[model samples]
Target: MSLTDIINAVVSLKKDEVVENVISEINKGTQVDDILDKGLIESMDVVGAKFSSGELFVPEMLMAAKAMQAGLEVLKPHLSGDATAEKGTVLIGTVKGDLHDIGKNLVSMMVEGAGFNVIDLGVDVDVEQFVTQAQTQNADVVCLSALLTTTMPVMAKTVEAIKEAGLKVKTIIGGAPVTEAYAHQIGADGFSDNAPGAVELIRKLMAA
Candidate 1:
């Protein structure tokens, strides 16, 4: 019935309630931008905070992201071009030789819920595909994920390729085996171990 209701619905991971509240708000003549920013985006911020504090885990974060996505879908058609304008374009993937996707998927969903235009390259993505896609999509940030230490070198290779290709995109690395030291050693712009933190890192990188 209100933006607060939409926020609460999303924070509580109530997909149905979030959808209903979003539609109700639109019917009530509420501004699409307000519904998106104050309702949906803000809910993710709260969810991220809880996640950072360990009050919520990956499952809860995924549920919240899903709830927010549900509300976003309802508001999309009503949004004007300017209202739905993306903050930035993010290209994300699990690096080649690494088929793990849970962390990559989580970051993709969380980043999308945070209002970025996310292009997921899926698992086992190679260096050329990443460079080509970054150019093709004009990505602002390229996120590399890896679960196996053996595949971590591909992150370095991808980051090198992006830079060598003269692309102006920021590269960030993450996954269980990735570390800030490795990110720096590989010449990446940043690194984050968690989904919410990755969203925040992307935001900061874009802002800079």
Candidate 2:
């Protein structure tokens, strides 16, 4: 019946309630922008905070993101072009030789929830694809994920390729094996170990 109801439903990871509340808000003639911003997006912000504070875990965060996605689906049809204008474009994918995606998938959802237009290139993505997509999509940031130590070298190669290509896009890397030191050693623009921190890092990179 209210935006707060939608927010609560998302925070509680109730997909049905979130969808119901979103539909109710739309039926009540609420602004789609308000429903998106004050309702769904704000819910993710709260979820992100809880995650940072250790009150939520990956499974819980995934559920909350799913709930938020449900609300977004209902609102999508009603959303005006301006209402869905993204803050920036983020190109995310797992580097070549690594197929793991739980962390990548979580970061993709979290980044999208934060209002960035995300292009997920899936697993085993090579440096050529990364460079090509960044150019074609006009991405503001390229996020590389690697779950294996062996695959971590590809992150560096991709970063080098992006820079060598003379593209202005910022590059970020993450995964269980990735560290700030490795990110620096590889000449990446930023690094994050968790999804929420990835969102924050992207925001900071965009602002810079």
Candidate 3:
């Protein structure tokens, strides 16, 4: 089967088909990174565009992300260290005092689909945890998410702490209440309002 077939499977939300096709491609000696970037990652990029155009919604995006993750599971073992380093590492979480996760989960899946090695710290993550994990993981980017205005300040604190720690990782922030202006005011390296945009934001930050 062609890589487009796998991408179509993911976009159609056919998780098992994605896995089976991915394995088939691997057995046929297809390069792991090619399948990931051309099939899985590109599918999400399309899905994100559809979402932006009102052709798709949250539930549909979630299903597509799930399908991509299924394919990723089959390809994980074949991903060499050099392959991962090429995409860079990402450390992501909901800032302190926040329980929201839907946005964060979506970003995590899309970032992974975009070829990054993502370490998700889950919700209600403390500022110190962000710094500690970013350092421990040698992350190339640290992302914070918060849905509440109250928790927004924590994002700034986390960014400051990362800077204070003198880590070289770039910092990005996002969520329902977050904006590009807020990102700049808080000293974050980047901001995205959606999952697909999050992947793009991370790419730009890493490039910079």
Give lDDT tens digits, candidate 1, residues 5-64: 987887788999999999998889988778877888778778878987999998988888
- Give the alpha-carbon lDDT of every model: 0.86, 0.87, 0.86
In candidate 1, clashing pairs total 0
Native-referenced Cα lDDT, model 2: 0.87
Error (Å) of candidate 1 at residue 157 is 0.4
Give stretches of model 2 more than 4 Å off: 1-84
- What is the Å distance of residue 81 in model 2 from its true position? 19
lDDT of 3 at 149: 90
Selected candidate, larger lDDT, 1 vs 2:
2
Q: After superposing candidate 3, which stretches have Cα over 4 Å from the reference?
A: 1-86
Give the TM-score of each candidate. 0.61, 0.62, 0.61
For model 3, residues 1-208, the per-residue Cα lDDT tens digits are: 9999998898888999999999999999998768877887788878888988999898998899888878877876665432344498999999889886766876787788678999999999998899999999999999899988999999989999999999999999998889999999989999988777888888888777
CA RMSD per model (angstroms): 7.6, 7.6, 6.9
Return the number of clashes found in candidate 3.
0
Q: Which pairs of residues collide in model 2? A: none
